[model samples]
Target: MDAGPFFHGTKADLKVGDLLIPGFRSNYRPEVVMNHIYFTAVLDGAGLAAEIIPGDGPPRVYEVEPTGEWENDPNVTDKKFPGNPTRSYRSAAPLRIVAERDDWTRLTPEALAEWRTRLARMRDENAEIIN
Candidate 1:
């Protein structure tokens, strides 16, 4: 799934923010592998909405199109992505890039720093591999 909004189960009506971190994979592999990490958006409905990057600067806002289609096979509930079947409805369009975050990156500084530090450490630890 691309960045922006996406639901966990089959609920599309509930919009949830997401952090699309590039160069990190979910599965076990070389630490230097360049993949993407997906982070769920968390924040209160009141006041200005921030991406909630811990120890970051002030919260920033971004324009979301509310475009996504999440789905799941009724028979499959325990399985996750890669081969899972499910569906989600949205009021916008699908994400063209799984690593779309220029808008989000410009907003939450702390979140961005956290991601950067982690990536640097990974690179430092896995100097033998190229991401």
Candidate 2:
């Protein structure tokens, strides 16, 4: 599942040499501080994640490299899908940004709306985040 030229998506205006580290609040469960930085091999999947996170501008996808050991993102690995179909992983170490990618597809308005609704419902239901 780690067959990646990995990518991370976010709204942060980071440069090619920037590093993404862990120890931040979980985007899904804000009350939990994340110990791992997440990434995926699927570009558009990162784009979708970027869209979910708040930012000053449109979401951006970045080519990245994990600086240390990583593992299947427990949040999705068997908890949601049967395996790592998304090719998502997380690391306690830093991820170095290699370049910015602009080719990922953006979600349509309807799709975005549906996502927002789903997120709200998850919040209402007290959905759990593995990390």
Candidate 3:
């Protein structure tokens, strides 16, 4: 899988807790991060939080001191989801970010079926297209 984007340098202004989604209810670390993106729509901490100076396109890997304890909570790990792996603190890593456009055609079968049904009903009703 492609790492989305890479940022480096000491973002002292940014807090680890800042990467955390507020009112996070997941026991999994990755899920927590995904929930942060799915609900809050942010991708700052999907991977490891590191301290390095960013280069032109990708970032230069640098040794970063651990800011806090990396906990391996089973309550958050050892689970399975449909598409993505279960989130774990161990899965955290710092990597270069890659940019790509979202392909909406990759949606789940159930979601596609629902959309098809909705569209068919709309077509039958001759609903005016609203944008």
Model 2 sits at a Cα RMSD from the real structure of 1.1
Top-lDDT candidate index: 2
User: In candidate 2, what are the lDDT values of residues 43-130, reduced to their tens digit?
Assistant: 9999999987754787999999989899999989888999888899999999999999999999998998888788888878999887
Runs of candidate 1 exceeding 4 Å displacement: 1-107, 127-131
TM-score for all models, in order of appearance:
0.22, 0.95, 0.22
Alpha-carbon RMSD, candidate 3: 15.1
Q: Could you give candidate 1's per-residue lDDT for residues 24-118 as a string of tens digits?
A: 33222343343322223321210112332333454433323333443332222344344432332222133222222224333256755775576
Candidate 2, which ten residues in sequence have the lowest lDDT sum?
50-59
- Which parts of model 3 are misplaced by more than 4 Å? 1-100, 103-105
Best by TM-score: 2
The worst-scoring run of ten residues by lDDT in candidate 1 lies at 7-16
Candidate 3: tens digits of C-alpha lDDT, residues 25-111:
322221232222111011232212211222133212221222333333233334333433432232232322222212112335575
